[model samples]
Target: MSNEHITTGQAPKPVGLYPHARRVGNLLFLSGVGPRVAGSGPNDSAVPGLVLDHNGNFKEFDFEAQVHSVFQNVKAILEASGSKWENLVDVTVFLVNMKRDFHTFNRIYAAYFKDNQPCRTTVEVNALPTPIAIELKCIAVIE
Candidate 1:
């Protein structure tokens, strides 16, 4: 098995120290993704109104839209690696307010995962970048 780093223009480029995703053998390791659009922060052209809360407060979080953006980022990386959601083998979700938004999270999550439920673990975290409620990272095996 060879190690390959996958890059895609469709998704937001990682900021600090990570690749979008990496492939080792038949398995792909995707990094945690937040609701960030390309060239939108500390990078190139800024995306106005992309920030959920202007004051850096968690109370004004846009949960649904953030979740959707996370999945869209995931989709872009997965497709770039020649894989899809159906190939997902495992997923781990991190939430800043799990108790408050578990139901809404489930509903949004179900739309993407569907009946092909991969092994998953969800955890409540104290905080996340931009104070967003949710962040997701997954692993998939390409057949």
Candidate 2:
């Protein structure tokens, strides 16, 4: 089957050389979607709840705010790719500070995924490409 790269002006411009998602057959593979804004944010949500200095170091951290914002960004990507949140089959979440924020993140995540549950794995990493603390990579069936 042929695969097509997906790009949407509605989502944040990628921080690197990658399309927002890719489609093959009836499945859509989303890249790690962050809570980044397409344009400048006075709240600086490009990394949700993260206030990054010019050097890409965190100036503040609000785990709760970041959690919900990340979901909103992912929702936008699913819509842009003609997929739905309920169609998501798999999700891999990256967290920079699992010990400090996992409980709250999990709570927020459960609320967002209350009705539609998808298999998920959350892992802690040292960092992400951007200053953000969380990101989600998912696979969804485009129905």
Candidate 3:
């Protein structure tokens, strides 16, 4: 089978020059999906996951809310590819502050992946392209 590039309006339009996800054979690879809201157009500013300061550090960050938005965006991309959360096989998460936020993120992650939990690796990064504290890049398989 040939590769299929996927895009969806339900999630925020990608800021970079890439599709939301791509399929090669039965496996699908997703781009790093952030916690931005789907803006009206490509150039419109996506609503950030939570409040932030000039330095892009959290002033009053809501980890749960940010996690929820990121997961929702991931869900949208999966649905667009004829898959769902259950089909997710792996995920790589980026967190701006692992020491401060990992526990909350892990709790929320547990709620989302109550079963069929995919293998995950979370890392602390200096920053994300957006002001959010979390992002997810995932992989799934479609029948």
Off by over 4 Å in 3: 40-45, 52-59
Model 2, which residues run further than 4 Å from truth? 39-45, 53-57
Q: After TM-score superposition, what is the CA distance of residue 109 in candidate 3 from its true location, in Å?
A: 0.6
**Which number leads on TM-score?**
3
**Residue-wise C-alpha lDDT for candidate 1, range 65-101, written one tens digit per residue:** 7778878878888998989978989989998888887
Q: How accurate is candidate 3 locally (lDDT)?
A: 0.84
Cα lDDT tens digits for candidate 2, 2-110: 5989887777777778888999999999988877765433234466566867876678978887777778777888898889889999999999999998898888888
Tell me the number of clashing residue pairs for each predicted model: 0, 0, 0
Using TM-score, rank the candidates from best to worst.
3, 2, 1
lDDT (C-alpha, whole model) for all candidates: 0.76, 0.82, 0.84
Q: What's the distance in Å from true for residue 42, model 2?
A: 16
Question: How should the candidates be ordered by lDDT, best one leading?
Answer: 3, 2, 1
Task: Tell me which residue pairs clash in candidate 1.
Answer: none
The clash tally of candidate 3 reads: 0
User: Can you write out model 3's per-residue Cα lDDT over 86-126, one digit (the tens) per residue?
Assistant: 99999999999999999999888898899888999999999
